[model samples]
Target: MRTEANRRKINRLYILGAGASYALTQGQTESLVAPLDIQFCQRIKDLQQRTRPKWVAAAARRVEKEYLHHVDFQITGLEELIRQQISDYEFIAAIHPRRTRGKRTKEEYLNDLNHLAAYLLSRARARDQSLLEKWLEKYLKGTEKRATRNRIITFNYDTLIDNVLLNWHSPQHVYFDNIWSSSTKSPTRLADRYPLLLKLHGSINWRCSEEEYAKLFNSAVTTDESKTTTYNTKDCHYIDKMWINNRVCTPEEQETPLIIPPLPQKPITSIAIFRYLWTYAYEYLYEARNIVIAGYSLPPEPPRVSRRLQLLREWSHEQVKQVFT
Candidate 1:
């Protein structure tokens, strides 16, 4: 049994999923109802419709005919096909030699599926960042206990939480994500010891350039678009650039970093940077006294991640207390 002292002395953390914010607004949830798989299948159809170089078209047609069609060729079907291709390619081949291609490699199919999934999920309804701000305000207010420290770990690409933490540029709200900072100063040791936000899956507002990438595995923000963004060893650097920097105050310049278009495709492996961040977040969760799970279904597709958390739960003896502690 966990002693009251142990639980009371622990830290507090929250794990959020894309669904968490969406849940706050039914309208937002409805907007995300467009299944990613369906959209991806449509994209493939769109690609087939568009006039491409003869070589490109031919390769696509070959992939579609030999690979896509065999998997029932529906948007919903792509995920399973990708999974099977990776873990059971040989078994799949025995079932259908023509589609599998005698020399077909599972990794290639998996890659295709990843790109497809990323595109599809990208289409999920735009979350109401405003609503998120409200919820966060309430949550944070309830979290004012002096002895308790609070932090958040999120896998989402949205910035609703970012806006809330920074208090709409209000001086009162001094919190920062530090995901995109280019500061040369040593990292704040307080960040290491205190509860701090960790973008385990990366955020949408982060940006970087090639130079920053070379100097630091990743740096947070840079004035130079070509300069690489900084990243801590904890996250994968593969997240989308959050916001573009525009020195020009003109409206045209402000619109340069429009969010990437959503197209149905396979899942992109999170940047290795995300992997590290995620691992750290998990460690924090196990140690934290309170945990609030929001907006995630805990999919089994990513077995490693779910497994890690499960192991933590077991190790904690299911004795982890809630944040109210």
Candidate 2:
């Protein structure tokens, strides 16, 4: 049992989705939603056309014209088509250094995905306008400076709620204990007085490697590197920064976006941090007193995700009480 649960009742647990962020847009406009999910193709196509570093714009356009040609722009069921394209070896062989002999260069696929990740990072201004906004406003007025516990589990790669919780709580208190480890379980207890936000799909602003990044970006990015934070894992050195500040980083300054794209089986889910996140999400689900889902439908396109999350189907059978969709 979570130690705090024994002493103080855990407050409502919120599960957020793209809809939550969509609700945060300047006017809650569809066009202003962060660039992921159904909007990915259109947003990436638009971004490629106008984004900076003329070479990147040209490269993105070329890749879309050639590889992504099959999907209709802005269509509702495009994810089915997207899954096909993502699995195509002909276009994305560039992701593998030795498999570089295809229609697209090794750099194009990587550039496009990172470009999309950077786009999401630029929209971090979102979390403060939704339920989180209301919750924090109410939280600050309460007498419980310590002891009360609340939590949010979000699938969004954007740092909207993550940033909000960070402002009100120490960063360490917001995660599973030792979250970087793949095998970690819940801590018997966590810190008090603030909500913890679990980002299941990973964040665009999460830690990435400096050495790997150097291969993609020009040395010029190093000038601002000193302002960033770095730490060593069991294996390599990583810096807690993604691309530099921009909707689309210039080709020379491009650093890959760290967010996981929605593939049936994400190539990176094997990494420990993400596994640890999902494990915690499962624990929090059973522990919460109340659960509310916002802007998430648990789409079935990513077959592996749907299969792993078969437990969600139990909700329809009333396994958990008071679920608000």
Candidate 3:
């Protein structure tokens, strides 16, 4: 709950990342560790060692300097065996240093990435819904002034925010679409009065469809009603169904495009749902006055997001306030 004065202030925007929700969800600090890509690189080096590749030795040394010192320096530190497979002497060194000798296979590496991604996202989603539900109750119950004029803009692709707001009986209140046409001015329609949640990168629950928006709305609402899991708490269930057909495929099975990765790419094929989301993210930024950012690293877009954030910073002049809180 906010103070009466703060509640009366202008609409606020919230930017969240894995860390933000991870904190609320009781995620361990070690869970937030990086060196994720390095996990894959190490595996590559291990495989190269057995069947000496042209670049194995050099790559191993470079990887050691780049990352191994902090984690595994013993094998990498071996003056002559840096590129060698598990020689008898090197094997002794590996055991002494408590480092695994074989690098994980490609498939194994992919599984590791997926496991990390899933754990991080699970923690984030759980926390995201908890916070959003608190604010949403305020909006629905008309508890505060700021709650009446609030919207959320996040880089996450999780369905936590979507499920909470829609469950609050105001699906129209949350705006997920991105309208790109310059001529299309912002509408002061009934939905505009409701709180908006623009997921900039995209979300797993949403799909590109040829179906009418009305049908989609009805279907979503129906699904919302069917979900018996509680929201806004660690006890809440994970909405794995949100992902394309409830699919959490391995790297090889991830043939279709994705929106939840560390980076995002424009789908060459037409994905109407994604187009709508990307458009609305821009719109949310355009209309926002105060943006609250938390744990998000602003990545550059060709002519959007990053540049817009830069311009916002330059022109803010105390007009817009970005707080990590």
TM-score of 3: 0.43
In the predicted model 3, the residue pairs found to clash are 7-146, 178-276, 178-279, 178-280
lDDT by residue for model 3 (269-292), tens = 123343344444444444546777
Instruction: Point out the worst 10-residue segment of candidate 1 by lDDT.
Output: 248-257
Q: Residue-wise lDDT of candidate 2 within 1-325, one digit each (tens)?
A: 2343433234566788777776665454444556445666566566575645466556557546655445565452334444566666544465664654545542345555555545544554653466766776464223335534556778776766655655555444554433231112222334342336677766665534435554322222232223212111222223333321223443445344445555545533333445445645655666666787887776645544662354354322223556677
Window of ten residues with lowest summed lDDT in model 3: 229-238
Where model 2 places Cα greater than 4 Å from the true spot, the runs are: 1-9, 26-31, 49-59, 66-69, 73-82, 90-111, 124-132, 139-145, 175-195, 210-255, 267-269, 300-308, 311-321
State which candidate has the highest TM-score.
2
Which one is best on lDDT?
2
lDDT of 1 by residue, 1-325 (tens): 2333332233556777656545544465433532333334445444454353343334334446546334555453444544444445566667877866566464434333333333334444435656656765655533333423566776554554564565533211222323323212222322223334565443434334433222222244332232222223232334333232212111112122112222222112233434435445555655666777776664654545454345334535354666331
Q: Indicate the TM-score of model 2.
A: 0.66
Candidate 3 Cα deviation (angstroms), residue 112: 11
Cand. 3 Cα-lDDT = 0.40
Each prediction's RMSD over C-alphas, in Å, is 10.1, 8.6, 16.2
Worst 10 residues of 2 by lDDT: 228-237
TM-score of 1: 0.49
